[model samples]
Target: MMHSLAVRVYYEDTDLAGIVYYANYLKFIERGRSEWLRDLGIDQAAMKENSGHVFAVRRIEADYLRPARFDDLLSVETALVQATAARIVLDQTVRRDDAALFAARVTLACLDGSGRPVRLPKGLAEALAAG
Candidate 1:
């Protein structure tokens, strides 16, 4: 039940040494998570507008295992590891071929328009549970 996205490393993704900047790995996984939700028919904007709820990152436990260089084609994979009423935990990885370059355990919290923690929408909870 892994959701994956393909990303090509560009010159802009690289640091002065020509390897991808460490922080950019977070960006790559963020895109992967967005696509994963989209694939599940969850629209963040719609959720915010209709349900008055939005998602925010609560924590991330990340590991930098290897370096990805410019021009590399990478795959970001995301899977739901756990889900609760107010939070979801995901395991994500950035890989080049068979090698893992980065990995993270991400916790996302659902929040109301006022930024107060709230329960996840039933649809989102069900989708993750089914997966």
Candidate 2:
């Protein structure tokens, strides 16, 4: 399943050139992933509180293709690429209209409160698989 979130580039999101700063694309995609999990009925806060488990980015391979200027309406699209006991892989893209501005493959690891790797919650794993 694919999930998309809308983002508007504000002045703060841009650099002196009035174009979105490269790092902000990561923020956009992060929101996309969070919303995607929410849509799948995964409550991150509850999971962390109840199970002491949280997700952290383990790796990211990103490509910046085009520039997004201030005030541009952008869409961040996220899709699950794979899910495992301890990790999930996602493909995400930032687009303006139909044009892809940035793309990334992100790997996220489930971690315990102690910051040690842990298996994903059963419900979350199942939800991701079903989706």
Candidate 3:
């Protein structure tokens, strides 16, 4: 199943040409991922404090299909594509209604405080799978 979040383009999200800056698409999907985890009862800060684990974006493959302009209302659709002991992969898209404007495959790695790879919390894996 896919999870979604709504985003309204702010002027700051745009360039002088009125289209959203290329980098901001990453921001939009990042929010989608964070909210998805939040809704699944994951508190990132608490996870870090309790488990000494943090999630880092290890890789991203993105395609910008079209431009989103200032004031455009968009939805970011996200779904888990895969999960491993130390990594999670997500498929995400930014859309206007049914039109896809951007798409990405993001890989997140679980890391210890010392920045070494670590297993994701068990509860996190279960929750993400269920969600």
Clashes of 3: 0
lDDT of 2 by residue, 61-104 (tens): 99999999999999999999999999999999999999999999
Q: Tens digit of lDDT per residue, candidate 1, span 17-110?
A: 9999999999999999999999998999999999899989999999999999999999999999999889989999999999999999999999
lDDT of 1 at 80: 92
TM-score of 2: 0.98
RMSD of 3: 0.9
The total number of steric clashes, by the backbone 3 Å criterion, in model 1 comes to 0
Residue 31 of model 1 has an lDDT of 99
**lDDT of residue 108 for candidate 1:** 98
| Order of models, best lDDT first | 1, 2, 3
Ten-residue region with minimum lDDT total, candidate 2:
122-131
> How well does each candidate superpose onto the true structure, as a TM-score?
0.98, 0.98, 0.97
Better of 2 and 3 by lDDT: 2
Q: What is the Cα-based TM-score of model 3?
A: 0.97
Sort by TM-score, top down from the best: 2, 1, 3
Clashing pairs in 3: none
